[model samples]
Target chain A: MSQILVEALAKTYRVAERAPGLSGALSGLVRRRWREVHALAGVSFSLEAGELLAFIGPNGAGKSTTVKILSGILRPTSGRVEVGGLVPYEDRIRHVARIGVVFGQRSQLWWDLPVLDGFDLLADIYRVEPARYRKRRDELVSMLRLEPLLAQPVRQLSLGQRMRAEFAAALLHDPQILFLDEPTIGLDAPSKLAVREFVRRLNREQGVTVLLTTHDMHDVEALAERVIVIGHGRVLTDSPFASLRSGVFAERRLHVDFAGPAPEITMPGVTVRSRDEGSLELAFNPADIPAPQLIAAITAQHAVDDIHVDEVAIEEVIARFYDLHDAREA
Target chain B: MAPLRPYLAAFRARFQLLLEYRVAALAGFATQLWWGGIRIMVFAAFYGAHAAAAPISLADAITYVWLGQALLALQPWSADPEIGHAVRTGGVGYDSLRPLDAYGFWYARSLGWMLARALPRAVLMVLFAGFVLPLVGLGEWAWRPPSSLEAALLFIPAFVLMAALAAAVLMLANIVVAATLNERGVNSILTPVVIVFSGSMLPLNFYPKAWQSWLHLQPLAGIVDVPFRIYFADLHGGAALQGLALQAGWTLVLVAIGRLAMARMMRRLEMQGG
Candidate 1:
């Protein structure tokens, strides 16, 4: 059985609607109107133990709502979930004891207290033994290179520094599963890379199941073996990273850095995206013309040097996918 | 009994957080002293003329004002702003994921903040009013202990507990307002109530004979009046014990209600969008 199991999960929120303007506001006080919003229509997935899955989606695509439900924070309007053979919301305390969650935008540490003090408080809260807690804190502090920051107040730490502390704080209890909600958001490139590396090690070495939701495509490529693409509160695609990239966006890019000034070249199916002094980029759907065929056709016309081929960026793929989805819905 | 270590750790953490803002505490001390002086001038005028006709003597009245000023931090004037903001911004989502019970955790922390705010201020205010002011020949205006220092000191534990409970009750109430009414509504609902009934403005007797009984039994009265009355030996042995019992009773009831409300509010809790 998978460590995390969710099926046909759905959630709707009842948001109060206030009329605009002074007259609308006055009438709203007498009797407010409410509109039901379906945050999750039907999101279903299962996570096997030791799996690192990246859940990707556009904003308001229910990525968070889905994560919240799985973490036992929000109740689903409909569907079933069994995380570690326990219904998270129903068995909250016991379930929460076994799972760690890091919300990138929120810090669990006391803002005014030193980072070490917050760790100690969390240790008490999680009921971690003194010996084990010390060992774990030392290990994580060194792992994240947080020893120099141990005595600093959290409010004084930079966003990157705080997130590192947050990661250690979440893991102090030695939870079997970790949920990272946009863990790399707003991080500098090196910080993002460090976080990705840490999460990869945590998943691979410790066999810790990680469900990472992020918008940074590089994070997905670096850490996740499988990617789950969600849109409109439903699973649009789920497969191995390589397969998902090809399946959802069969388009690929070819960059030819010429020996000198680049030549303007276009095939029947290929579109020239940009041209620079010594290079040009092309976008082509694999279905329109196989990448090899396009390359061969390209070499037939101009001298090719330092040629590179890559898939379309995940952001662009998702954007075009959403445009297709919205167009279909409209 | 529940292991108190976790609660104690929370308490210590909260205390440390409050102490970090030492400048604010100093400002608070100055503000309370200023208020103390004004109350003295006004009450001295009222009592200097009618000392014979008053129920509480001039000395007791002045003591009441000083003690109220010193112990002012103990009142549940507002919800624990951190937890309240967390709930408002949905930061509470991560907060609720913690293993601790929200009620006990917040209660312990809130009590910790109050004690941190109160302990030093209370000591300094008492020393300044009782010792420094009197040394300057202001004894008539300074705070004085009642006939028995031992008895007054003895009742302090009960008063502090009562005040902490009142704070918890008020903090819990603000959650309901914050979750439903948002942040503005929290200020609108709580500000007036904290100022009026919490005894910061004036004593219950200052109102009217008709409202005295009800006013004295209020949660704020437990915060200021009951504690000070015990210190003044206004309510002796049996009555003092009864007062402590009543405060404890109210605490249990209010905490229970607060816990249930918290559990219910969190059941469908929502916060800042992920």
Candidate 2:
């Protein structure tokens, strides 16, 4: 079943046009002016039950705006968004109860209160029954390893510690869907890995539908099965993560080391990307010259001691996707 | 049983947060003590020079001053800045997403916090004033003390209603401010207004009749008027109850408007993109 549906999700903002200097500022006071900026333009997508989808885009690409609309905090300028068979904005109180949201930059916890107090308060805010709240809170505490941290005030906890508590707090209601906006943006290396591992387990084992928006390509590579690339307030591409990377920009690098000075072996459909002492890097399109053919070409004329192939990084693939979309639009 | 239960639960959490500030709580009481002392001296200097033939008795005046000082911390306008902060910081997004009613949550939280501050100050002011009143020779060692029996009946409800009224008005004012500006801007404008109109700086009686009449009709004066009238005018029975009713009426009216405005503004808020 489709768990989320968004159609033509457009949001435009009327921003006050303030002038550059004192004279313009004085003039603006007499006659205020506004210019409309379309934050999202006809965005549309759908997610099936228990799907792990990574929503990625550059800054100001409407990633957070989409999340906000879906979570019921924002009403779209014109669009239809149905989560769990209800319009999120119209039935916000009912719809929001079933989903949880976590923003990496902000915390939902009361800063002066202990972590347990915050979780307990959330239990009340979500109207979770005492018995159910207790059971779920305990489960989340254990899952997030928040036992020791629960007694400390939210302000007292370190960022990593606080983030774990935040994740647990959002889930204490046992929300069916989790919307994480850059959940691991500024964490240290180990903390980032821990969050990634936890998210992976939550999606695979628990079947909790996860829609995560992030700048980190590694997070997408580590957790998301499908990727939705949005840019300029539109979804440019949506496909399986692996296929999206492989389908576009198929240039792969093959580095071969020879026992002697590298031979300039030239072949059709194969171009030398770079070369170093006793090693050469060749770029080739698999459609024209397959990896095996390229390897054969190198081995045919050169005494190759070692060799390895590197596919394009996902970041490069996404950048190329952006360039391709921009070029077509232009 | 349905929505009320969760609101109560949230209120309990809010209460806990309000009382967690031990040092601020103590400092709050100390400041009330200082103000009480200074205001009592003002009354002393007046009674000391003039012949004691005024309609407002020295005893009643003394009690009024002390309670007014004590009640300053309990006034409802406390929640306005919080609303402003929420609006300014974009934290209102998370709050709006919660299943609770935005106005009710803030109103309850403000009431809880006022109780936290007010309860302590009330105790210390009564105790310290009890000690100092005699030394100053202000009547029979008690400034209109209702005996132990009347204390049980009138003062508890009086303070509670006062706090609730204050919270409601403050929350309403905050909703208006939140719709337009952030907390810092609201605080800058609203604090002086609260100080002037609520009679925190001086009792409404001290103001001219027209000013007093205007302030009395407002939500601010409504919060402070009942407690002041009950303590100073020696009003009881129907009149005192009516004062309490006015406080209740204002609280209900303001809270209703606040809730409606909050719901409307929350709908219009574009927190994520803005």
Candidate 3:
């Protein structure tokens, strides 16, 4: 059974539009103007138990909007959204107790309270049993390395340290599904790695389903096997990372360092993409020119000291997808 | 019992949190003291002017002023600015997800803050009034604990109903302000209205006859004025019981209205996405 299901779920906001200056403000009060912004346009997706999917998009791409709707925070304007067999907006309290949400930019911990105090308060809020709460809290604290920070007031902790506390707070109830919205944002290198590692283990070892939305491509690359890209209130692509890479840019680069000055290497199937001095970079589809044939031809033609092949960057692949999406819209 | 347990725990936690900020609580109490002290002086001035042909004894007027000052500290009709803060900051979304009821959680927290603010202020007002009022010939005022029968029958219920009504009225105001401005400025503007109608600044007795009648009908008057009239003055008969009933009735009605408004607003709520 699917852990989360959303079908044709749409949400539109009636936003007040105002011009600048005092006269405009007075006119707005007398006769206000509103523009409808379609935040989510028939967005539909489903997730299975223990599935870790990255929901990626550009700014204002309805990523957090979808997360809020799924987590029972905001009601969708139209269509159906079911998580764990319950309509999220209608059964908000029941649904929320079963799902954990961690927003990287905001700490859920109480400002004046110690980290443990916030966790204990959450235990009360969720009505978790004392024994189970203690066990889960201890496990999450250890996994997130929050023992040292547990006694400190939340306001006293650094952003990275506080993010660890937030993770522990969200998991204190032992929720089955986790929605992470930019959970590793603003973290240092070590903290980011720790968070990624923990999220990976949580999904793989504990069978906790995860739906993560982030601007950090590295987070998607490190954790999510499957990526779902959305733009302008629509899903652009949903596929495994490898499939995306291979399908978008299958051609690889071959960097050749010649023993002497290299000659201009120009072939029908292969072309020199970049070069400087003795080193030459080549690009060609593998189907058109086999790597072995290309290498042999290069070696035969020039004295090569070293050679290496590189895949296209994931950022470039996503940029191409965005350009395609925009062109279609235009 | 099941539903009430969560509220009880929340109430306790809220009380603990409020108590931790002892210095802030003391400062809030001091501010209340300054206001009450000024009102008490105003009463003494009035007594001095009318001493020659005093309609009521100087002691009675002094007692009435002091009781009004004390009860004003316990007035629950003040809005919590945090509700607006929570909504604007997107924290209210998480609050809505708690398993406990939203109205009960806020009510309990507000009650906890009232006690934190009121208890110290009551003590300070009593001490300060005792020292200052008598020197100005406001006459002797004694700690006349309500006679046993009156205590058992009148004061307890009157106090409870009055506080509940104040809290409920403030809560309704909170909902309206939260919906309109997503801020608590509406309540700030209405504070003077509460003071005038609730007889916190002076006894409702001093107001014009028609205005007094209208003020009596308001929820604010039931909170402090009616209770003050019963306890501080030697008002005859079951006026205390009747006023208590009126206060309780208003509390129930306001609470129901506030809850309905909150539910509707929450359904249409939108949080800023960052």
Candidate 4:
């Protein structure tokens, strides 16, 4: 059975409307107007146990709305949501107790208290038994390598340190499902890798079902096996990360460094995207021409010193995919 | 056991957070001291001129001022800014994620804040006014301990109940602020009204006979008037029980209102895509 099942979920936000300028502001005071913003328009998805699903969307695309509903922090305008066989909003307290959530931009730890103290407080909040709490707390601390920073106040910890602490805090109860919203956002390269690796192990080893939402495509590429692309509050595409990369934008990027001057040689399938003094970049659809043929053609033209080929950056693929999704809807 | 661990932990956490900012409490104490000094002088002069005409003896009036100063931290109004900031900045989303009931969690925290700052300042002020200030020659303007042991016995329970009511009322106001999201209106409207009407600015007895009776019926009177009357021997057994009943009634009423408001606001927050 699926650990999380959401069917035909919809959420509408009643937003207060006001005209611009002084008169509009004053008129709003007496008689306020409102407009409805449909955050989610009948979204549906399911996550089997131990699945790592990356939910990708643009701003206000309802990624957070869905996550909130699934985490039991939000009530849907309509439709159904269940986590661990419990209706999230209807059985909010019970549903939430079984799932852990981490919003990247928010820290759950108390700012003035030491990191360990925040952990203790969370242990209490989750009602973890004292002996179990101590054991779990120490295990997470050592796993996260949080020993050195345990005594320092949360305010004093670096953002990277704080994020790690947040991860440990959210896991203190050993939640069956983890919902991470932009968990790697605003992190340095190393920190991002650390978080992604931790998430990967948590899913693979502990079998914790994860629903991740992020704008960072690297995070999606590195962590999520399946990607759910959302735009305008609708699921645009749901497929494996590899297929999504090639399905919309089928081109692979090739970088060639010549032994001498780069030649302006034209090939049937490959198109040069950029050229410099001794190196040239090309894009070619592998469907039309295989990568080996393209490389052979390049070697035949130029005295090659070094060559490399990479799939089009996932970020660009997503941007183009969003454009396709948006155009289709329009 | 249903497990008091979570609420107790939240309370302890909140107390520790307030403990980090004792400077704020100290600043509050100094401000209250200055205000108390001025009120005491004004009341002492009035009672000296017309002792028979005064509504309370000079001792009771001065005691009221000092108690007001010490207990100012316990008011529902002063903590509104913190709750406002949390809601406006969207930080309260984390709070909503916790497993505990939102109303009980915050109520415990509010009480923790009261105990952290208000309780200590109260002890200090009572000691200084009862012993130090009187020996230093402000005899009638200093605190007079409860007249009989019976009064202290009555005041303790009343004081505890009043604090619980204040916590509930403050939590209710915070839920209103969260639901409304009108920080400026609450700041400009709610705070001033609470400060003026809570009898924190001036004791209700100072008002005319007709106004005093109804003013005692207000929620803030349970916060201030009930405790002071018990300590000052101005209230006996029946009246003391009545004061306790008023606080208990308000506590029950506000707890109900607060829980309902919190549930409604939580749904509203969810609908708003919190």
RMSD of each: 3.2, 3.8, 4.3, 2.8
Best by lDDT: 4
> Model 4: residues >4 Å from true position, as ranges?
A18-34, A255-268, A272-281, A285-296, A299-315, A323-330, B270-274
Instruction: In model 3, state the lDDT of residue B205.
Output: 67
Say which prediction, candidate 2 or candidate 4, comes out ahead on lDDT: 4
Q: After superposition, how far is residue A38 of candidate 4 from its true place, in Å?
A: 2.7
Error of 2 at A203 (Å): 2.1
DockQ of every model listed?
0.68, 0.61, 0.45, 0.63
| Docking model 1 quality class | medium
Q: Model 1, range A1-330, lDDT digits (tens) per residue?
A: 888899999988889899789999999999999998877888888999999999998777789888888888888889999999999988887888899999888888888888998999999888898999999999999989999999998999999999999999999999999999999999999899889989998999999999989988888889988998888787877889988666655778899998878987857868888888999899887877888898888788888788889877766777776776672234
After TM-score superposition, the amount by which residue A237's alpha carbon in candidate 3 deviates from its true location, in angstroms, is: 1.3
Ranking by TM-score: 4, 1, 2, 3
lDDT tens digits, residues B174-240, model 4? 7777877766655566677777777777767767787877798887788887787887878778988
Check candidate 4 and list the clashing pairs.
Answer: none
Error of 3 at A277 (Å): 13
Candidate 2 local Cα displacement, residue B40, angstroms = 1.7
Kindly list the per-residue Cα lDDT of model 3 for residues A184-295, writing each as its tens digit. 8889999999999999999999999999999887898899988888877788888887786566657677889999987898887787877899898888778788889999
How well does chain B match by TM-score in each candidate?
0.91, 0.84, 0.85, 0.91
Candidate 3 collision pairs: none
Between candidates 1 and 4, the TM-score winner: 4
**In model 2, what are the clashing residue pairs, if there are any?**
B76-B166, B76-B167
